[model samples]
Target: MMHNATYMGSVSSVSSSSIIIELAESMGSGIVIIEGKNYRIGQVGSFIKIPIGYNQLYGVTSESNESSTHDVEIIESRSRRWIRVELIGEMIGGEFDRGISEYPSIGDDAHIVVDRDLKQIFGQPTAGQFTIGKLSSSDGIDVSLDLDRLVTRHSAILGSTGSGKSTSTASIIRSIVTNNDDVRLPSARILLIDIHGEYESALGDIAKVFSVLPDSKNPLYIPYWCISPENLIDFLCGNISEAYKTLYLDKAIEEKKKAIKTNNIKDFPTESVTTSTPLPYRIKNIWHELYYDDTVTWKEKEHINAAYAKDGEGDAENLIPPKFLPPATSSNPPFKGGNNLVKRQLEQMKSRLLDSQYSFLLKPGPWTPDKDGKIEKDLDQLLADWLGHDQPITILDLSGMPSSRLSLLLGSILDILFESSIWGKNLKTGMRNRPLLVVLEEAHRYLSKKEDGLAKQMVQRIAKEGRKFGIGAMVVSQRPSEIDETILSQCGTIIALRINNATDRGIVKSAMSEGLAGIIDSLPVLRTGEAIIVGESAKLPTRCRISLLPPNKYPNSRDPAVTASWTQDRTPENYEALVSAWRNQEITKEEK
Candidate 1:
């Protein structure tokens, strides 16, 4: 028996399965010890305790009472006035009967127990890990991850503006990297896709930062040729036209190179080469020529051919050469040019391909023709750097990728990881036992139910089947309502911070157990860093104060207050000088 158990309080009031308990003089924040045993009285989250009969009753804490115990201020909201504690589990004889019931009625002498079997419920997290905090007033509990889970499970930190979601995420990452013994987490694989370029200083030192712009120390190169052909078409053509799509598919069939059974020329002749295997080719030019170019035409029930415009330096034959059909064919003649339409189209494509914005899309690497298809050297290198390397953390800095192409870029990463882990054949021998944890940040934008987008497909698959193949996905999103319900529901553990939106709150409530649903209703009023954690990972839902992380763990999203910043008489002149030089001076391109 613990010392706090001696101060047990009895039920003083009862109504509708709710019990009101008179607080002991020594009761305080979080847990109160009574009669030599520890018991929870109030939590960071709000709830109310209800009293029923038979020494057991249902009670829940609504919120923490802010008024000093000596000077009580009258507050209208019941959640603010009374500490809510839900009846979860009770010790019955030698066995533990989980979940509280048999409401203790008025005048029932029930021992006040707050820290009821906490050790058994939350047991310490795996070695090399520590419990930072537990969800307040919810049936499910979430533990702030250190290096052990973060590196192994891959995590995404997401939230809306001012949600403290970024702070929480950065804090967790910082904890892992800083606290490891012997720097055990040095190779922890971490890839941060900075959407707004906010996490530069937060992780710059320990982890190498890569971006498209030259501002960062380590720059990323998205070679144009490295992007998958399908991804290239999607990026170049937005919501492709029906005619263009049909023609593109038709072209895909015609250009396919068949497999060669024998390298010997005597066994397979050039003229007799069959078209069965898909071949490596550029879809950007092919799609552009077929849809926008007039010189490249398909005859009615006749073979198609490309032609050069008359204004092309009079080298029309050189510009458009006969392909596929041999020169010896009797019916095949050079296609006649209708106008300069094809030349204009080709020029447009060439211009776009050369543009600065599409530079990353056009020049990826050399594409080699393989029996399977065209293999990009850049993608192979990237994969080798990410997975083949034994290092635990791989930080893929995607800040430089064009905003329009971000979805496809992220989708490709997910596809690669999933295909490599699940489809690869080495399970029986247990040789290739590498389990990957893919963390998708800002998941709501790409995995929204409204779009049913590609990210949603890949994430959904990972959520459903990735776990079996040693793959786990952590989706961090502020707007839970906007995310696909299937993916959200599939998450075994949920770490929710302060969410004020009614719809978002409701979505969280729907996925949790009935006991936890009641707890999520109070999420809007939670303080910064205070969250309601619920899931399989916790014992009984507990209200725990998350320990403060080191300064390096601070997220970049926190903005300096405008009022305070303006109050200073003199400010730094870096931004002002840059703008002035660009506008007034004939600045050299490099200087600007």
Candidate 2:
């Protein structure tokens, strides 16, 4: 071993996975000069080496404190500093591997690890690995993640606002798509759920973006019938009586079966049609039938006055029918009590149908059902445009959607993709052959534990069972505390950026391995675009500064210059345009 005079400390306590280091009394200052190179003593999150025979054990300093164990009566005695380190891995026979085979004994010399030792531990980037950035301690050494484990086991990227979370996410994705040659993962399929419509401009060159309103070249559509019955009812009707729900389900099933038979859809099993079945049916027809049942009043056959009046009134426009409105006189005939139980639901449906904001779902081009309950397009065509595309990345932009229904819409999208993957797993073009990675941006919005909505449930299911079916999820969020704990715990890897909130940091800490819990305390002080990665994907817990990208390739999440804007002259045209966009519930004229 190369000898130097930069020794800082010696191991005072030994454990299977950690060791406590007592600083040398001769080291007066925390800084040391070795071979004309200056190195800091004990910095948390930094690496330390313990050499025993031909094997060298590596650890990261997690905690450090000044000690006063000696008697206070000795005024001339100086206080010593001690560091607590968590053993990460070991290097044996000049080969670095994760996990220690031998533990260091007390009195072992602990020295700071330099670039050469880091290079050996990190190893060279090979197939199935992509470099994210350089190590924070040593810029020369790069940090690479295992792509196979990253997708199959699942991962998460979390940080507070303005901490460069979006840029880090974009950089990671860009690396995956651009470094395919080095990683040997050319056919990577990634679906990004863009909540703010920011990634399109950043990754537009390599990604195919689909939005509520797309340009002429790219058609965007999400068929309403594609939504499961439970989600559909939740969106259209806030609340309804049990009897009304049963009636709705029966009508929906009847309509779906009829449409299947009429269209001769061999792919769908007509006899097994259920409320949750994906067969296309006319929503308008269901509404019309329900309206007829809710408002109509029955009359006795012996009531000749009512029968003659009905015939005479049919020819006159002024006469009102009992089917169209509630009866004015209750004593006129023995009739069923007013069955206006679905009045609120019908009203809600009418409002949703008329809202142009929902045109993408309700009036999807070619996917819309006609009066005869026939559609020009099918789910297969939609899936081809989304997953079976030439591009490796597909961005589903949901910025124009209403916030109130965003969770439901997201749930529908996940359901469609997951359900398709399950049924088509054995096929040549199924997800088993082409595994998918779904990146959910702002995941906390829909995955909070407070509500048991469809989005949360579907995401949870994907986290649990998706790996077996060739599906993976990358949950990106700023508020980790608010996200579902079950989903967070399921992630095998977590890329944590600078999180300042104590609650958020605590949540991340709990999800991470106990050995790495001490490193999480440095989260609040991490630089922008720098993160500490832990779990299956990373060989060892590492702090890395994400490589920078060009301005054009950066995500469009830069904060607006308030001071600069205020210095400029105000314009009426700008305000007018903003008002127009707001009133139209759209970002551009194409959406309107």
Candidate 3:
């Protein structure tokens, strides 16, 4: 059926499932015709299959020659070029006949087969979608990801410090926002939690940049005071107090009773309230009131006139007079509890609440609590502001905040989105249709392999099950080994750039399917901007030069060569004068 089946090479090298076919002579044609089909068998991403024994061996045409010599790295042995693959499995029975034998000698016959079908493997997404990578070889080096994958599935652009990871992330995001035709995701919701505030200028055009204190012009407003009390405590204090805990549970029960009463449900218990309820706003309000509002305390009105003063020294602690107590209790009771444990707990809670930084959180304005410790504002509005807003990109710049709470803050936001999306089912009625993608930069700082952070938990859930619910996570980190294996293993696609660390390389190896191990071994040597893509989303794992992102739109990641600049003989003499001139211009304008 097909001709030109030349004896190009032989199986000079063999592994478990494949052999390296060394060409008798080198052939340098850019395009190779194999099995009656023309394929662009160029460098990096191209592959060819040759008959080995009973099974066929697959190899990417890494080196092609016009003469008789060439080198091909084996991918897999198959009957057809199309690799309908699962994962690693055992090879069954096979034997070599006289016609197919000879064990691939130096001059044995070998021919390139048709290019592996990528479109068939991954299938075309929507019309506007662009392919990212593919799962082709064992190395898990070549794969494709769609715009849908980049935006919705959540992606992490991870690599070492000098690996051009940021540029790769920017390039992919830009392609999604700018390149698509039919299905422009103009309203696509993306939140980049900027830890170092590095991406404001880079992603300004496509994203809403949020910055801190001095950069007040950025409209990112996360009112810490507005976060519900229970979440606030979990985020800031790490744990809640016993008395405040009791108060919080009481508030929740009371709120529940009110809701039931309004709906005309008669039976409601007055006692046995516990602090483990899911009603966030009610608990938040109780914490707020107990910690703040010195005016509400009976001790505030203690008679400090001459009667409370002893030896001209006033005791603020024991100065609570009869007039300051509640009317019925003060008139009837002498002493009940041996020691005021509840009172002591309340005092401690009050002190923590009254501190300047914490005070703001206790009674944050616009999200104030009612007299009965109920939040006045609705939670739906908060949800909409978070995910359903008009802007596609929302940057939660945490530059001003202390690093200690960064992980918790990020985690709370993630938890809210994930829980709401999964439990909030009806799109036609409530908040369900739009899915959120959270890109965690510097993930190692929060999510690690050994320790569990809230971000890691939610991220793992999204990675494993978010697709069904329209939620996904992308973990971007410099240290991949520091991240949890469960999350990394669940990733449907991986875009591994140049990695130098042996430990990091080992971790990547562990995550990939076994057949692709050799491809990954070449990782440390990969050039900048070159990557190996592998996963279910790709047709074949092929090494290819990723298209470079535009300089203006890219992150400011490249370090300057200071030594080269210093070595230059010529230097600008008017550098100080230039600065003075700019200062003079500013002074003149202010004088005018």
Candidate 4:
């Protein structure tokens, strides 16, 4: 057993969840060697123990300071060093559990926690635990997380740029998906929304990669008809008056009804259909009908609607006469008015149709309708392609997509998943039976509080109620301050890397427990790949150095070597290929 010589201080004050200790003069400001073992004294985020009879209480040192009493005799004056520690847990009968049944009284002895006590506090690796990293103070002690709370209760990973955020994310995902004898979580399903396509190369062998370019065998496509009416309008029409919106909705419903009748799909009731219904309809046909209403003219005398303006003799109006004949004049005029309300909408629709960048949504193979207003494929095929794959991880690579359409695209994808999970809750393949973890990278771009886009709404919904339905979200971002407070608060566990900005640190600190203020203050100085984990999934609030992955397993997020690139000779052939890629809107020629 450890002796009283190892004791460094006595508790000066006690609270419900914290204790303040005044250090002894002999153990001030540096490492204290006890029994030839070097033990660091009174550091922020380090642990200390207080023994009260048979039970021992563990706490993390949150703040440390040295102060002197104001005395006139300066030669005889002395300073006292003290540390403020937040109580983490208590150990009884050699087993550690979070929460304290009894608080240590003032003047109780405080000792530095050693390796044996740390092993007991962290507990042994079991079936439900996965290693995240090693303890910061003791490099040899591994830190593990409970997988159950990590997935079902939700989590977040936040850091600054170049702080190993992506690498840590990849490590956590790899640990969960990799088949191991000790960890029993082998059948997990994870969906990763890769905003920059940095993860495909890192996890491709173990995951199924999907992209808009269709360069891979398994291409990704989100049919236009699968999106909600609100998002569709946001994509196709920038903005419109309420009157025009009503007109558009009526036409959309008419088109959807025509498609249902043509395809002979009776699963849905015809009378209950709305504009937001997920059904295939001919987009071209709707445009044609709207254009005709906007531009078609009629003969004034006949008072009959005509596809084209005609002359008094019922002949097509001739602007010019045959060679050498007198030029035609407008004797009987065409109708002076037409429905021009949809002119701007028609122009926007035309532009989107001609742009190849939107082909993934508008020109999805077999999902697009033919001239006869019928589709060869349905929503089931699209869902199967996204979620029914044999691989445990599915990566949706959005690097090739247009930046302007990112908000709409993200919202539509999440809506599809949310709706599917709700409807298929009872099925064997549903989310309830086989839970899903949807990882959203660069979440701040779409999930900001200033915007109420569909992506934000769906993510907020999943964060609030997803646990009961077996749906969990893992939000990854570099800016925690920009993320929605409601969504961030819903996360039961937080893995924070080095955050340097004051505003960002303040936001993160506000979300954490009050006792951990000192740990929060240490965010700016954390080393790369080191993180402070707190909340439900962790045994306690811990500062750990995340294990470094092999070069091959690291994410593709390294900065380019500036000097090396500048020194290399430039080739005309390389420039030509680069221009070709720029013109084609693709990353490489092979994507074509």
lDDT by residue (tens digit), candidate 1, 322-392 = 22221223444543333333444444544656554444345433433333434445344555655555444
How does each model score on TM-score? 0.67, 0.90, 0.65, 0.90
Over 4 Å off in model 4, which ranges?
34-36, 66-78, 179-186, 300-304, 309-333, 569-574, 589-592
> Top lDDT: which candidate number?
2
- lDDT pick, better of 1 and 3: 3
Q: How accurate locally is residue 523 in candidate 4, as Cα lDDT from 0 to 100?
A: 93
Models sorted by TM-score, best on top: 2, 4, 1, 3
RMSD of 4: 5.1
Q: Taking the tens digit of each residue's C-alpha lDDT, what string does model 4 give over 1-592? A: 4666678888877766867787888786568776667888878888999999999999998877733322212212436777778998889999888889999997899998988788888977678888878999888788998888998889999999988999999888887767332323446789999998889767787788888874646667888888876568667867866776666678888888888889998887788789878887777666665566565555554646452533322211111111111212465555533556777776797678667788888887788787777888888877777777777788999888887778788888888888888888998878999889999999999998897777898999999989888889999999999999999999999999999999989888988998798899999999999999998989988999987765787787889899997898987544787787788777863433
Pull out the clashing pairs in model 4: none
Error of 4 at 274 (Å): 1.6
Residue pairs in candidate 2 whose N, alpha carbon or C atoms collide under 3 angstroms: none
Instruction: Tell me the deviation in Å of residue 524 in model 3.
Output: 1.8
* Backbone clashes (count) for model 1: 72
True lDDT of residue 519, candidate 4: 93
At residue 424, what lDDT does model 3 achieve? 78
Worst 10 residues of 2 by lDDT: 312-321
